[model samples]
Target: TEIFDGFSKTVSKCKFIPVVCGSSLENGGISNLLEIIAKSFPSYISKKHFKAISKQDNKEMQIEISENGNFCGFCFKTVLDQFNGKLSFIRVLNGEIKKDDEVLIVEKNNKFKVTKILQPFGNKIEEMEKGVTGDIIVLQKLDDISTTYTIGSKDISYTYAFDKLPQPVYSVAISAKDKNTEDKLISTLHKFSEEDPTLIVKYDPETKQNVISGMGELHLEVYFSKIRKQLKLEFETSIPRINYKETITKQVESRYKHKKQSGGHGQYGEVAIRVSPNKRGEGFKFVNSIVGGVIPKQYIPGVEKGLIEGLNNGVLGKFPIIDIIVELFDGSYHEVDSSEMSFKIAARQALKDAMTKGDPILLEPIMNLSVYAMDKYTGDIISDLNGKRGKILGMDPIPGGLTLIKAEVPHSELLRYATDLKSITQGTASFELEFSHYSPITGKLAEQVIEERKKFITAEEEE
Candidate 1:
């Protein structure tokens, strides 16, 4: 009793959290943990109000937490059941809810009928006719519902402000072992992503792979384990490829002539173009310098189209080219034989020739990375980042004996950083990264990337 009282006092003072060790699999210390929570945790009624956004006025407002008000709550979690379909777990913050009541999903602005109100106890669930304020209930068969969506009694037009999900740091490119099950695998992954907002699933068009990202390695492993157990399907996972770009470093002029004399009207088109580097991030620019009807106006679109298509695959590594200017200054056409198709071929060939001589280089995406860890592990963390080719920007000491280390690192180098950081800090740190900019890549590292790309292309062709 004395220990319980002391723990309660310390928790109430916001000094520390009381920890209760338990194993859910064995049901060890479960009852004691529940008892402590019931006795020590603050009641929901004690929370005065919740901040929410008014959709009508686009302003923030406070919603009072009272049992007499209209029904208001939010979905905190969701689960997919084979037999019951999607089940959304909601915490009722105000008023009451009954079976068949229509509720509004604030974010989606859609209404859904509550078919069954259920109360969960471990693995068992009991049907309830109604749920009152402060009760956590499950609604069955809410297929379109997702976590963090506000639920109100069809009248409130406010969305409760919820904490945002952290950025996913670890990623893997996944595919079904059997091609026949690929569609099913993708559909199931989407369902899982809907249930857990932190789990991100997307198809990378550049890499041509289905990628899934999450908080860390174990987080992804848990989903994969669940998927295997549920679907009984074979799956393959690999490290995702970084999306690199290509650009020119200098100006070069090239010419190409498309001509064929095997048919009645032989194709004929000739083009001269100058390619030069543009300011970074400006993307591809097309400038037509044709004068006095040289390279007729009708074929200009075809030339531009050809140039854009040429940018799709750079000579260095077949990566998309960016931040370059192509000037179509001179060309010749046979009035009887020249056509848009002929000009397109000529322009495409010209751009390819120019790129090969324009001092082309590969560009890799850089990420702005911020790591938070205890001060004692700062040296180890910095050392690891240095080894990954990370450029340290600065470090600031934060509260709680922690430090925030800021750096810019190439995206390819940090592919497994989530696991690496955990190992370096003994799982005592967290990090977030976002796309910063594209930087030039050269030398041995660039050679390795280009070689890997070649291997991937070869494997894809063989497949």
Candidate 2:
């Protein structure tokens, strides 16, 4: 057979043919033909006459034509069915699978039953009872199964971990249009994220909004469209807010007292705390430096807890506080009136007082940005980046007249950078951004941010 002769020579040479079969008298397809050659005629691709495709001539590549063995499947995508919750699309790499068979989730280290199996033909599905190696099948109601999970047996301890997708480069704040659908929106978002590894959904406590991020704006748009079609939920999305940090610069001492007198009992607690700035990114630190029972040991945790709550929002712009150390030196407490609640209040007030007097400042998140553009647009791209308060780090030239530009830019200035770059380069330039470090923002920009936050809060109150 001329087909057998051509396939044997191609495998021996290890050459990648663009189209293996065109107009032919073949039975099944190219895959079935390869299987026949591998199993029935393994000698056709003997090592003696083989050429390595990856330049690893010394390495032995096992070509197994598995017919009916242990169940080994790799899940790549998931589809939502009307009757069943989720149907995982899996390609059986080795072994045969049947309905009601139990398989081990390799990565999760859990066992799940294959409830109902189906074969996908285009957009339609037909009930399937058994599937062999190299056949694509679907299993119903595997809720916990996600993309790239290996479904196999415990006896055969082999798992395949696919390469992870790239991190999301764009984000937008999302909220359900109807308050009643908010819970359902979040649940559906999580389910969509399981199917698409590039989709990321997280809650931003700073702005009190749900954020959906992906590789680009279009990626998120597609997800939102699918959600609307499948779950019949509408969402409102806007630019995500920047999460700024607040920190102190100088050491300061603060003393606060909580005194309340009621008919039954009185509350009295006093605390003295020394606040100092720590190293950048060191976060918060609480130290108890009491001696001679000035402040009782039992109530010390109350002080720390109060201080932690205070750290959630700083005096400047109410942002999260970071890189600060608080030392509890000395304080006076009443034997009968002092309690954890009183101490907590006193500690909270003391920390806030210290921060206000300690020269608090606002810090904005910086992003490490890398832009790839053709040489013709490098100058324009760099100029546009500079306008966004970006600091150029370095530049490198590569083949095809492409230049790579690396820089650091503030996250606030990049909310719409993806769209702007596409417009500037006419869809020829691309860039990726990642969180770097927090840097201080001063003068007009800081004042503007505070003003905007106040307006946002006021609008929420009105609503």
Best candidate per TM-score, number? 1
In terms of lDDT, the best-performing candidate is 1
The ten-residue window of minimal lDDT in model 1 covers: 4-13
Which regions of candidate 2 are displaced past 4 Å?
Answer: 1-72, 93-100, 127-133, 155-159, 226-235
Query: Relative to the unseen true structure, what is the C-alpha lDDT of residue 92 in candidate 1, on a scale of 0 to 100?
Result: 92
What candidate 1 gets wrong by more than 4 Å, as runs, is 1-16, 21-29, 53-61, 66-71, 93-101, 129-132, 153-158, 227-230, 252-275, 285-305, 326-347
* lDDT for residue 210 in candidate 1, whole number 0-100: 99
Give per-residue lDDT, candidate 1, residue 41.
70
- Tens-digit lDDT string for candidate 2 (1-463): 7876776667556663434453345544767656766743435213322111111233433334455556678898887766766889997777788887888987677998877789998678899888887789988887778888878866655555456578788899988999999999998888778878888899988889899888888888898888889788888999998898899999999999999998767898899999999998788999999999989998899999999999988887788899999999989999999999899999999999999999999999999999999998988988998999999999999888899999999999888888888998898888888889999999999999988887887888899
Predicted candidate 1 versus true structure: per-residue lDDT over 220-275, tens digit per residue: 99989988998898999999999999998999999999999886999989999999
